[model samples]
Target chain A: MADFATIGQQFVQFYYNTFDVDRKNLAGLYRDNSMLTFESAAVAGTAGIIEKLVSLPFQKVEHRVDTLDAQPSSEAGGILVLVTGALKVDEEQKPMSYTQVFQLNPDGAGSYYIFNDIFKIIYSAA
Target chain B: MADFATIGQQFVQFYYNTFDVDRKNLAGLYRDNSMLTFESAAVAGTAGIIEKLVSLPFQKVEHRVDTLDAQPSSEAGGILVLVTGALKVDEEQKPMSYTQVFQLNPDGAGSYYIFNDIFKIIYSAA
Candidate 1:
């Protein structure tokens, strides 16, 4: 088996970086069967996921990742990455914290694609 | 239905606060049938979960929450809260960020207990 932890860390960094700059480019990281649960909305397929992202209420956003943890799954070449970070939208006074779980499957050549993603915002401290 | 979003946010805050201070006291937040997935380990029941906590390596800890989001679930009186935060254990220089999913069931009188909990530490930014 390959070093899943190493690969998973790299994938996390790449995914978040791309999401901040060129979200459209992220399309390559997903396949036709990808699934995304944005808060309460469940979006399936790469196209539908992209559509939801483009239609988000926030215009400008910044993601500050605080932690990234990855573990191998029972399935071959499958990895689960749990990300906890803060998202800043526009000029909001406080950034919204979020927890996102990503199930990635190897697509060969040390690359992986997101199979499933679930994201939710955390509670405000105030 | 009641305002799920508001109640969920409040629950998230109270849960984390209690976790940091009196972890032992957290037993009240879980019933005998509660479920927990801590890292790769699956623990069932409040007794098992509390045992896992006492066995952790860290002695002193602090949690810094970044974001919190909650939504109502199909289950009656059930709320799902996703938390993103940084955890500082002992004297570690770098805090580990984590994403936790909590399924809370109202126990009446504005009180709630965890039915299911999933937690994972994120990747180290360095």
Candidate 2:
């Protein structure tokens, strides 16, 4: 599953890079019907997704991914990726840890776009 | 918040209960378009989902949920729930741990149905 691993790592890297610099560039990663859940709020469409990212309280943010697992789906050309990471926003607030899952649908050869994304800040389960 | 917590707990209990005895009863929880990811396989439609469950090698299975976190979604009637648990298939095989996430969309007043679910076995990150 090198393809899965490579594509997963590449997509994660591209996502965080774009999220840090040109949030707008991330638009192409989603379709009009894509669903993104930030915290608990669900946003739909490319415009809404971009707006949600750009409107984050922190202007400068960085994500450090700890664990990334990708699995090909039974659905034609679909992939499931799970990411666990910590996000540092600006320099003041404490870094927040998160777990995110994404369902990707193939857009083209070796290319996939996010179809469903669920992101949550990890509050201790204990 | 209470509503979310209550519904989350109730659903989890109801799910495991039905999963143990009458697996068919779980059918009402899903729609034709609902997506359930079992390991890396994605199954759609209620019939497909039920088939996947019953086809499991284990006949008598039990699930013990450890963490159940629920958040209300921005969607008018959607709820996002994350579950971490352990499952024992039978007397012979060792227990398997798992993490599952579910997106529930409102079906009727105070009623919801699973729209998307992702389930994975934990093999350890370290």
Q: Which candidate should be chosen as best, given TM-score against the real structure?
A: 2
What DockQ class does candidate 1 belong to?
A: incorrect
Please write out the lDDT profile of model 2 over residues B1-126, one tens digit for every residue.
347668878888999889888677789999887888787577888999988878878778888787676655433556667776677877845666566777677777658888777776654322
Segments in model 1 whose C-alpha atoms lie over 4 Å from true places: A108-110, B1-51, B54-126
Q: What is the lDDT of residue A2 in candidate 2?
A: 53
Q: Residue A12 in model 2: shift from native, Å?
A: 3.8
Interface RMSD of each: 7.3, 6.4
Local error of candidate 2 at residue A38 (angstroms): 12
Q: B82-124 in candidate 1: lDDT tens per residue? A: 6777788888867776778776777776678887677877553
* Residue runs of model 2 more than 4 Å from their true location after superposition: A1-126
Give the C-alpha miss distance for residue A31 in model 1, angstroms.
Answer: 0.9
